[model samples]
Target: MELVCIECGKARRPENLFPMSCECGGLLEVRHDFRRADAEKLRALFDSRLALRTGPYASGVWRYKELIDPEVEEAHIVTRGEGNTGLYDCAPAARYAGVRKVWLKAQGENPSGSFKDNGMTVAVSRGAAAGFRTLACASTGNTASSLAMYAAWAGLRCLVLVPPGGVADGKLAQTIAYGAEVYGIEGGYDIGVRLLNRYGEELGFYVCNSFNPFRIEGQKSIVIEAAHQLGWSLPDWIVLPGGALSNASALGKGLLEMKAIGLIDRVPRIAVVQAEGASPFHRMIASGGGELVPEPEPRTAASAIRIGNPPSWRKAARVLRECNGVTCAVSDGEIMAAKRVIDRSGIGCEPAAAAGLAGLKMLAEGGTIGRDETALVVLTGHLLKDADAIRMPVPGPALEPLAPDELLARLASVR
Candidate 1:
């Protein structure tokens, strides 16, 4: 497999590579050949090995071997078995939205407690194999934690650059646990990403962020797992929240590959759910500019969606346009409401996860999504990873238990 330049579509190897879009400027990305034979064999394999917990199959993601990539050895996949997430056949939610079939891709169940693991597994492994001792990336929350975990397993030094606005405490805890160098940049994730890209080039550090092609290869497995679980039927729509916008592109690649081998007939319409704070991609879709422009002052409680400047905005724009997709921006209050309902459904998705649900609700209410559309909204991360992050109107400290009357008297006095 070879990486392709997004600009020239020129193919190249990934090891110790640099962006050609430099002095001799051009947009580019590492591309992998999607053509593969015996693709239908995976369906038969799943039927035969559905309940086997022996050997590598026990690892949730590893069950689909051909989908994910690992550099050193296939066994050392750097996976906590991140894929094979539970899909809920939600009748109530479906009925509410008036969709034919509504399914939930609960990505919160991943190893890192977030969907970022899908990329980290491949990125960190390839980074280690490429002799990059130190790996770095700019993140909102989940990516930092996910990279930290994988880097620790790969025995590589990890650095996380975060902005003040996002970067949830739970995610930061993982970075600290890996003994990584954490820097809080005063600016947004884009500032950190640009600086890291420059520093990584000069300092010979590995940028294991979404820009790395290996990450997309790893994330593509989500769609693979989804299709297999669905008995090879593709959904009419797959709604997801776009931060840097890598996931949508990766998923499109997966579905397209499956389609090539006759695993499915069509790729689903991709819907990007974004926060009102910063919605440049949404604005692009509306205007059909397909160009990137930075957001001045993004404001929203869905901190993960608060990317003022997305690095992969161009590719993301292309994906939206090509897939006949639409981007919807939801407010913070609506996000919280969606979170509560998602929690009640036993999904336990974090705020970032709820962003998609909020968008689905909005789209349905506005009659943008037809009743005939069968939608699958991805619940992108685990709320348990950041327990209190979503709770609105936070209550005071927990009350202490006191002995019968004495405790009651103290409480009464305080009141």
Candidate 2:
């Protein structure tokens, strides 16, 4: 494996255990030779592994270890049964979005209640194998919870930096419950990341942020598993909410790799949705793929995706362009409305996760996504991850004290 710069195309050996970026200020992506692996045999092996009940084979992410990092020993693998999230046939959600077929990939069921576990397990495992005693990350919420839990499992010290008053109570509670040293930074996620980079060398800590190539490698399993769950057939579109843009990049990379290795006949067109208040990627695409402009003070109720400057912008843009995808931003009102629809389906998600449904509706109405096409919307986090956002009174319901005979009369009068 080699660390290849998304821009400048500079290739180099990863000197550190967790490679961050290139000297040219570009993100690094893990490049492997998939031509050496037999596609049909690999698919057969993965399918066979599904019958096994234990070890890495059962893990949704590690089941495709050859496609991720084959060099890592089995002993170094730290898994919490992550990545076996369900793919539900959400007909209600489809109708809401004006699509014929819509499947909700509920990633929130993963260990730590978010999609971050898909990447954290691999990053922490690699860090432990590389002799790193401490693991660190700058997170808004989900990443911190994931890193803390994985670090605890791997027996490594975890340090998390979060923007003051920026994280949700549930996520912060998870991080603290996992015994991580949490710091409240005055600035936001980007500032925390900058500080981590400045101090990581002296502190000897492995950064578990999406900037790490190994994390992306692990996150690629989301698409891999989704394809396998779909009987090796690719969907017409894959919609997801964008935060750091790593998930978009990872899914696109995984789809392309599957096609390269003959496991899939075609790759899906990816749609990345962003909260309008924190929509740098959407703006970049809207501005004709120009240089990414950061939103210095991104304001959104979707705290998980309230990222002003996504580090993986270039890589995500490349994937979107290559896959012929689109990026769109939805207002907070739209996001909450979509959230209620998803909640009514009993597959509730965090506000950030609802952005996918919101964007799907926008794209469907705009004729970008066809009503007859098959699409998959990824719900990234669990409902409890942002329960505070859902505390509003339930619509169309009111309770009043009444005598038993009056209640019976009311019940009899209904219909």
Candidate 3:
């Protein structure tokens, strides 16, 4: 595998250092030579691994190890059985989105309760293999929880930089509970990301953010595994929330690889949804596509996606262009409405995870996504990851009398 600069096209070997960008300040991507890979054999191998419930083969990300990182040995690999999330066909969600068929892949079902683990497993494993004693990242929540969990298991020091009061309480608790050394940045996730990008190497740590090419490799499994669950059929569209935009970038890479390897016949259109308050990516697309202008002060209740200066925007932009993807921003109210719909369907997700469904509704109304097209919404985080976002009932008496008259009154109001 070689690390190729996305902009300058400069290719180099993967080193032990942590500088993620190219000399021209562009992001890098991992490229593997798969010219000799037998597509039929790979399909059979991936399918056969599904019956294994132990070790690296059991991990959804590693089950396709030939595609993710063939160089990483089994002994150096780190996994918590991540990426085995379920894909659900929810009638209520489909009805709300005005689509004939829709599926919600609950990525929040991962060990860390978010999609980050899918990438973290490969990244941390690579770091460990390279003899890095410490791993670090700047995260709003999910990445911190995932990195901390993996680093702890791998016997490496874990450090996390998070915005002060920016992360959800449940996510914060997970990071701290996992024993990561946490620091608070005053300006929020954007500033923290900037600092980490510039000084992570100087801090003597191995940074494992979406900027890492290996991390993006593991994230490719989200789409690949979805296709496997769909019986190797590509969907008409794949809609997902955009935060760091790494998921979007990874999906594009995964789709291209699958098509190249004869795993699928067509590519799925990607739809990226962002919270209106923190939507630099959507704005970039709205302006007919150009360099990203970072949001100076991104504000959103969906803390997971409250990023003003996303690091992977360039990679994501390339994906959007290649995949014929569309972008839209949704208000917090719309997000909450969609969340309610998902919750009512018994497939609960965090506020940020609902942005896909909300965006799908808008896309359907605007005729961008057809009423009959099949789409899959990727839910990135579990509902409990941001429990504070859930509204509680008004304070009332602890208990009510079990009288027949009271029961009859409640019953009358129910319908």
- Model 2: weakest 10-residue lDDT segment is 391-400
Candidate order by TM-score, decreasing, is 3, 2, 1
After superposition, the stretches of candidate 1 with alpha carbons farther than 4 Å from their true spots are 20-27, 34-36, 45-62, 70-72, 392-415
lDDT, candidate 1, 29-88, per-residue tens: 545454664666867876666687565565555665555552346654555656768988
Residue range 162-181, candidate 3, lDDT tens digits: 98889999999999999999
Report the lDDT tens digits of candidate 2 across residue range 1-415.
8789887898887545433767777888889987687988998999998987789779999999999888789998999989999999998999999999899999999999999999888888888888899899999999999999998988889999999899999999999999999998877998888777667767888998988888999999998999999999967999999999989989999999999999999889999999999999899898896799989999999999999999888889989988999999999999999999999999999999999999999999999999899899999999999999996674444365778998889889986
Mark the 10 consecutive residues where model 1 has the least summed lDDT.
19-28
The positional error of residue 192 in candidate 3, measured at the CA in angstroms, is 1.5
Find the candidate with the highest lDDT and give its number.
3
Better structure of 2 and 3 per TM-score: 3
C-alpha lDDT values of all predictions: 0.75, 0.91, 0.92
